[model samples]
Target: MSLPKVRSTTVLGVFHNGEVALGADGQASMGNTIAKSNVKKIRKLQDGKIVTGFAGSTADAFTLLEKFEEKLGAYAHNMKRAAIELAKDWRKDRYLHKLEAMMVVANKSELLIISGTGDVLEPDMGIAAIGSGSMYAQAAATALKKHAPHLSAEEIVREGLNIAADICVFTNHNLIVEKPV
Candidate 1:
């Protein structure tokens, strides 16, 4: 028997005010075919203090997230340090290096973006997005920031998700969302 294939796109964003949000389309594809369209890609951890969004191989993303969660658990009271440590570990871990996935994470004080390049990126504007619809989501978010600076972080997230949903059948309102405390 052959192994199952998975394809899904995830989106994540963070506002300058330290508010963070994550969104994903429900679609998972297998070998040029649509498999599941309503899968959740955003996860909440550390009693709602941490949020993570994943893109790429679902299993790989889960594995990375598990490692991140463990690190978070170890440093619950120190989110920034925890994030740095997790990103550093993710960048260097041999197993993680082979996985084809991207993740955006946020804790109380900062936002971190990680990808297959083994780079830990923190945008100057304090925002980032990952996955297939990331570009679309990023454009929407940038527009929101320029045209509607007063919008709350949650509102920005909703707008980004709506834009993504319009273009990708895999993403919808039921898309999972997680925010920071």
Candidate 2:
């Protein structure tokens, strides 16, 4: 029996200018093939207080998002605790551990990456990116944030994703940006 195919995309998140924003390119790919565009890979959680961006298997990501929501509720809307709880479960649960996905989660105060490897990481520079275009987007955002102190968080993420789309074939122009008001 042939195994089901998994899809992936790019996700970026940053904290800048006293704001936190997350962005994602809306392109999905399967084995070098473009499957779809305009996908919403970034989301708001905890009554719109936290923003999360995800990469890797779409199905797995959706499941993780649900699980994360539950965790958030369990932790009383604490972003860090919920992320850590999700990571612990993701790593320890045999079935969940096998799911392929990564997440960048943020609030006005923090930016973090939760991995299947049981890691909940807070980026040193308060910026994080994941997926195929992650390296390119991260580098671009880092440079921009350092050089362009006047840019808003949304602007930095938009430009970062644009740069990633230029370099990564799996990334596209359909972008979604979310931040807390």
Model 1 segments beyond 4 Å from truth? 1-4, 16-18, 169-173
* Backbone clashes in model 2, listed as residue pairs: none
Candidate 2: Cα lDDT at 82: 94
Q: Candidate 2: what lDDT? A: 0.90
Model 1 error, position 24 (Å): 2.4
What TM-score does prediction 1 earn? 0.85
- For model 1, residues 1-181, the per-residue Cα lDDT tens digits are 9966686674757564556666666667776677877888888777777777888899999988887777767885565566567667767878777888888887766777876665668865656888777777788888887788888776787788779778865455556766777
Error of 1 at 105 (Å): 0.9
Query: TM-scores, in order shown?
Result: 0.85, 0.96
Which ranges of candidate 2 are over 4 A from the true structure? 1-4
Counting clashing residue pairs in each candidate, in order, gives: 4, 0
Best by TM-score: 2
The 10 consecutive residues of candidate 2 with the worst lDDT sum are 1-10
